[model samples]
Target: MGRTVRVKSFELVAKDINDVDVKLLHALSIGVGWPHRPKDWDFLRRAGHGIVAVDGIGRVFGSAMWFPYGHEFATIGLVITSPRTQAQGTGRWLMEQVFERCGDRNLTLNSTHAAYHLYLSLGFTKEATVYQWQGEAVSPPPPVPALTAELSSLSTANIGEIAALDERAFGANRQKLLALLSEGAAISVLRRGGEAVGFSMKREFGRGHVIGPIVASNDCDAIHLTAVHLRDLAGQFVRVDTREQTGPFADFLQQSRLGINDTVSTMSKGKRFLNRKENEPWVYGLAGHALS
Candidate 1:
């Protein structure tokens, strides 16, 4: 006679993120209070490569993903571990797996408060703070400073027009990511002397819409670039993640009713990630915490 026996423990192995059902990944994010939907997970799968920690029966317990901009750099994100597995080194194990796969590439990530110490132990240095501003968009937004540049709609076919400027601000050639984000997104470009000086994109993400990757040389231009999109999304749930703490740009967002929701620390390994110059083009708003 034989009877089934229950096991008290099980081992987990790394599996390709794409190999699992999208719902599983969605559930994994939701388990940790993250707002990623199935669609969002699918989009992330297309945007980069990732891995999930799963047991023999395919029950996922943790996940880690990396978005590579080039041979020398990549952004790590979506690192999540089930609550039951916390304090057991699952998070660090998943990170080590990502490190192995990433090789010697320089890495950057927006670390939540809970994971800050872990990252510091891994040799990541603090760079900046990313504030997540989100709420119901105001119809008129707020009054902006006088316009100094011509604002115009930019077609996806002409994405190359802003590639150089974006590279200058982001410190990487991520035109590929920009093209993927431009799919079904509302894109606007700021021009002076017939040259593209700044640009922004509003796209569907998370609970509602996100206006981000706002690139500009100063606060005023950033305000105008953001206001143009807020004007169209009035009364809808909108979100923007930015590193600007205090300035005309931050004030404009506060007046627009998008209050600060949460913040994450931007950390980097191998090289300094953020370099703000006096008047050079800067990333006023990030595409997403994960994508940053």
Candidate 2:
């Protein structure tokens, strides 16, 4: 007699932008190295883009998120699968749903070695390598006096200024996405003489936090702002995903005793215009893999 295998019914749902639990499950699966967490779910849904896959019983088995930069491009991340259901194609199914939702829009993601083959099989090509730096607590660095623009939290009143500074640092306008920062997450900005010079935004993922798009006019200001933000987090482990060109920020992570947890390949499938360079002093970290 042949062994019997259960055929689970899979249903993919477009998550409500306000569905917090689903978002938390997605975050927990990726950040805390777990499939899902009950407590944080509500918080995650309110943070950003989220999608979920449920079984016949209505229990979520997998989830993913896409952080949109513009209608033309989005980064996908927070892909997770329940351990009991591994090798059952839950992950692939979830990714397929994400691709379908993305539909002809340019998509990008950072893949770990464990998931590289999976992404390659899905038509993603390697674009750039990103190193993760883990560091020890050090005395908070002093703010750059020359760049001494007082940094402030992003708000509706100052969003236009934030958008303009982002364009100057990132080489493109991301006003649409930057505008979303005022909604739920913490967005910090640096101002000197009442003019914005730099800014950073953060979102909650499970128990940890991810900070990025840390745009600044120079390395010193970037470092200062980052240190301040990290200090605010105190005991929590935070992930700062930055581009290779961001100078002392990466070095600071190294010198501070932060470990380089892993290096991910920033892969893409379609057009490629963003190339890594040494001269670009400003460093920008993606909010997450899905939104990069």
Estimate, for each residue in 1-292, the C-alpha lDDT of model 2 and write its tens digit: 1111233544434344344344546553655374234534443344447666554455555677775555676677767666655677666766777777787877778887777888999999887877765443444533333545686676666678777666655445667666654555677877778877677876565446666768775666777667766767655666676655346666655544455666788887676625544434254665545445
Taken over the whole model, the C-alpha lDDT of each candidate is 0.91, 0.62
CA lDDT for candidate 1: 0.91
Instruction: Pick the TM-score winner.
Output: 1
After superposition, candidate 1 runs with Cα above 4 Å error: 1-8
Backbone clash tally (model 1): 0
What stretches of model 2 exceed 4 Å from their correct place?
Answer: 1-50, 134-136, 140-156, 167-176, 179-187, 191-195, 202-205, 231-236, 276-283
Model 1: ten consecutive residues of lowest lDDT: 1-10
Clashes of 2: 17
Q: Judge candidate 1 at residue 151 and give its lDDT.
A: 100
TM-score, one value per model = 0.96, 0.73
